[model samples]
Structure formats: structure tokens, C-alpha cells
Target: MTDRVLYLVVCGAPLAKRVGDGVRAARESGWSPYLIPTDAALPWLETQDLEGAPVLTANRKPGAPKRAPVADAVAVVPTTFNTLNAWANGNAGTYPLTTLCAALGARTPTVAVPFAKHDLAGHPAWLASLAVLRYAGVRVVNPHDGSSTALAPVASGTGEEVAKRFQWSWVLNQLQEAGA
Candidate 1:
């Protein structure tokens, strides 16, 4: 079986924090972690002192050899509406977009956790982009209240709740399905 790595991509500030929290949770859950930030997030990533973790800049070309390290299951946590739309339409003009397109084309499983406000969440464009993503075989998990769930804390009673509900079992299940 192929080894699985968890690729967490961050876009915005709020989502960046959630991604950090998710990374912490994933590490605590005993999974390997690989973090990459889009150009928009590079400054923030550098400020956090992520240590020696591989950091890919957003300015790099999308299909470069360096991006081959991306794993099977990628979680675009707190995906901005713009990024979601771009990926759905095959617009790999940015770093995150290029990485996501490459992974999807490689038949890698992708999970998107959108983080938009209620008003923006219900926008027609957002809904349309979601449909495109689903049609493209991307797993789109939204917040239960029809809002962006990834922006909220995991409903679990533990104070250590992540923005999204990523159970260890669920992750393992997907990995198994991917033959990892």
C-alpha cells in the first residue's frame, strides 16, 4: 500500500488559523503532515515559524516537478470562494489552484471545507461552484447549518475541537479506499 500524507493548504487568515489547528490535531492523531501555503499566505506562514516543513511558494508553476509530493487525500480547509470557483473551472492560475488541479487530475481524493459568511455562503456563484466541484468528483463537506462549517469549531465536546469534523476513522477509511 502506498503511504499517505495529509496536505493542508491555507488561503486566508481565518482559514490559516483553522488549518494550523487541523494540522495540530492531525499530528496528535498520528498522521504525517505536509503544509503548503498559497502566495497569498506565504507571509503569514513565514511568521509562524513552521520549522523545517516543506514550504512551496505560490509563485511557482502549477505542474512543476516539485509538486509531485502531494498526497492522495488533500483537504483544502477554509477554501475561499474564489479559490473554489477557480478550481471548479480548471483555472490553475495560482499555486493552490495548480496543486489542487494536479491532485484531482491524478485521481487523488480531495476534500474542500469552505469558510464563508452566511450571506456569502448562500450566494448563487458559491452554490454553482460547489455543484461543479461535486460533479468533478471532489468531496465537498459543508457545515450542517448550510453555512461554512470549517469556520466553526468541531461540535465534539472536547475543547480541542477542530473547525471541521475530520475523524481519524473517516480519514483512515478514505485512505483505505484510495489503496494507500
Candidate 2:
């Protein structure tokens, strides 16, 4: 399983700041993780220690060699509103979005942890988008308690606190259960 690849896709939410913890955990679990961050996530990543994993923030130049192995599974941590909607809509306009879209199309074992405030999650599009991903076989776990059945939206102004309490095991356990 040392060669198993896990694409740890990250977004701009405050939870993005704790990505290093995910990377380290992935390694400890025998997965070779590659960090794929959205442009918005770069700032948070700037301060993280990624356990020396490769960070693929942009698509490679045309004809350039592939930088990472094909993913055995994918985990999207701190899936932001824009990213979740775009991914559910099949809009691969950005690298991270493209990664997500491709992962879904490939039917890869996937777990998504959304970290959005209640106000933003109230948008009708949010529930619809989540349904879309779930129907497509993506395990959409609640960031609060890792529950797959119910997603409790984060309260406004509580993102930092939520990020702190997030457990990477929630995401990892889902992937493991999927036989990743």
C-alpha cells in the first residue's frame, strides 16, 4: 500500500491551514498523498508542513510529464462552496476542480468534507449540488462529526473553531472502508 496514491484536494476554507496533518496521517496510513490545492488554498498552505508531499496547484504544461501517479482514491478536505458547486456541475475550470471532476468520472473512491458556513449552505443550490455528488458515489462526510447521513453546516464566524476540531480520521476511515 506504500504505492497507493491519495489525492488530498484542498480548498480555501480555514480548515485548509491544517492540511499538513492530513498529509502526515496519510503517510502514516501507508498512502502516498499528493496535495492538490485550489488557488484560494495557497495562502493557508503557505504555512503548512506537507510532509514533503508534492503539491500540484496547477495543471502541467501541455506535453509535460505527469507529476503525480494516478490516484487510488481522492479526498477533498474543506470543500468550499464554489468548489463543491463547480464540481457537482462538472465545471472543470480550475486544476482542483478538474481533479475533482475527473475523480468522479473515474469512479474513484472519494470522500469530501465540506466546511461552509450556514448562510452559504442555505443556498438551494448547495443541497442540490451535494445530492449530485452523493448520487455520483462521492462520500460526502459532515466535517463536524464525519457523519455520512447528515451534514450540519458550520455556524457563521465559527470556521476557525470548526477547522480546529476536524478529524482527518473521518476522511481516512471513509476511504479505507471503500477499500482504497
Q: Provide TM-scores for the models.
A: 0.69, 0.98
Candidate 1 residue 48 Cα shift, in angstroms, is: 3.9
TM match of model 1 to true structure: 0.69
Q: Please identify model 1 stretches exceeding 4 Å from their true place.
A: 28-30, 43-51, 59-70, 143-180
Query: What does the lDDT read for residue 91 in candidate 1?
Result: 93
Each prediction's whole-model lDDT (CA): 0.61, 0.93
Clashing residue pairs in candidate 1, if any?
A: none
In model 2, the clashing pairs are: none
lDDT of 2 by residue, 66-154 (tens): 99999999999989999999999999999999999999999999999998888889999999999999999999899887898899999
Q: What is the lDDT of residue 33 in candidate 2?
A: 96
* True-structure Cα RMSD, model 2: 0.9
**Backbone clash count for every predicted candidate, in the order shown:** 0, 0
Worst 10 residues of 1 by lDDT: 153-162
